[model samples]
Target: MRNVVLAHALARDLNVSAAVIAAFADAPNFHTAHRVRSSGSELLPGPGKPLITPLSYQSIIAMTQSLSRQASDWGDLAAWVNRKIEHVLLKPRHKLRNHI
Candidate 1:
């Protein structure tokens, strides 16, 4: 699935260091969290700074699945949340973004 596609892409681009490829392929959020910390955090970090940990990865996956289930449970309430977001003070930004 996504892992296969990403590994295929990395293999095509980076010819050396299967360790690097495997690490990248395993945790998709490593790249994203790195980007955020490097730009948005108080301390800017290099890309090589280890952003992925066993606990953090577990938390990310757990939270993702939980949020997905919540959205499904909510049904059109998710849609309503998105529509009314701008009106609320300090709105819940983690609410789903329905692109449509």
Candidate 2:
């Protein structure tokens, strides 16, 4: 499932758990929510910032499963994911390359 794959990615990168992922997935936008704000992560969405949210669990599941089924190019997938998380997980250019 797409959510499962995403959950794994989030858990690995953000150091969270299944419950946390589920809670986040259940949110309206997965960012513009009180719980996400309280999460204290740089990934938090704020005014003027918006994030794509899956329309349904089934959709996410179908998406991720499709990726796997299609044997999607891992390099391309990694590039896409990097674009999404680098800003929130990695350090700024001036901070030196000591990844977070």
lDDT leader: 2
* lDDT of each residue in 34-75, candidate 1, tens digit only: 543455322212354422222333344445557785655455
TM-score against truth, every candidate: 0.19, 0.23
- The residue ranges of model 2 lying beyond 4 angstroms of the native Cα positions read 1-62, 66-69, 91-100
lDDT of 2 at 96: 26
What shift in Å separates residue 59 of candidate 2 from its native position after superposition? 8.8
Q: Name the weakest run of 10 consecutive residues (lDDT summed) in model 1.
A: 17-26
Task: Record all residue pairs in model 1 with backbone atoms less than 3 Å apart, i.e. clashing.
Answer: none
**Candidate 2 global TM-score:** 0.23
RMSD of each predicted structure = 14.4, 15.7
Residue 38 displacement in candidate 2 (angstroms) = 8.4
Which lDDT values do the candidates have, in the order given?
0.38, 0.44
